[model samples]
Target: MITLLLADDNPRMLAALVQLLQREFVIVDALASGEEVLAKSDTVCPDIILLDISLGDLTAFQVSDQLRRRGCPSRIVFLSVHENPEFVRAAIEIGAFGYVFKSQISRDLVNALHAVAEGNQFFSNSET
Candidate 1:
């Protein structure tokens, strides 16, 4: 099973995503902020990180950058409510394997995860 570390500022959505994916993935941990991602990632040593862009105390960009700087190898898949191409570009620049919008989670998140986990990148339905 794929090991995952999930971080989202929104409590409800965070919980819902965990509920949706936990059975399918070995969720190593969940966190509410970017700080937690940096702090707990070593212990979890996840295969992938599903990070919400607008973390409570830091942006996903910031958190991802920090992780990379610290030499964490976990692949990142960014989740956001934002659909801006600039945001997508930033995530791609940061080496995110996928960039998914919140509105599309029910329809796209699972597929996106599956694709990214298998070494394919899936930005969104609109990307292609």
Candidate 2:
């Protein structure tokens, strides 16, 4: 089973995502902040990380940078409400495997996960 770590500041969003994804993936960990993600990542070693870009205290980009600097091999997927072209470009430039917008989660997230798991990039259509 694919392992996933989820990080989102909103408890509801986190819970909803967990519920939505748990059936398809093993939820290695679910965190409410980037700090928690950074703190727990080494222990969990998830195969994929679904990160909210607007995480409180530390942005997902910052967390991704830190994880990359530490040589974490998990594929990072930005799960955010922001659909700006700049954000999509930045995520791709940062080497993230995917970027799925909140509005398109139901339609795109599973496909994104599958694509990324296969060593491919998955960005929302609008972003591309």
Indicate which candidate wins on TM-score.
Answer: 2
Residue by residue across 6-122, what tens digits does model 1's lDDT show?
999889988999999988898888899999999997666688899999997999999999899888988899999899999999899888899998878888988888888899998
lDDT of 1: 0.89
Off by over 4 Å in 2: none
Residue 54 accuracy (lDDT) in model 2: 88
lDDT of each: 0.89, 0.91
lDDT of 2 by residue, 1-128 (tens): 88999999999999999999989999988999898999987777788999999899899899999999988899999998888889999999998999999999999998899888888999997743
TM-score of structure candidate 2: 0.96
Candidate 1 segments exceeding 4 Å error: 126-128
TM-score, cand. 1: 0.94
Which residue pairs clash within candidate 1? none
Models 1 onward score TM values of 0.94, 0.96
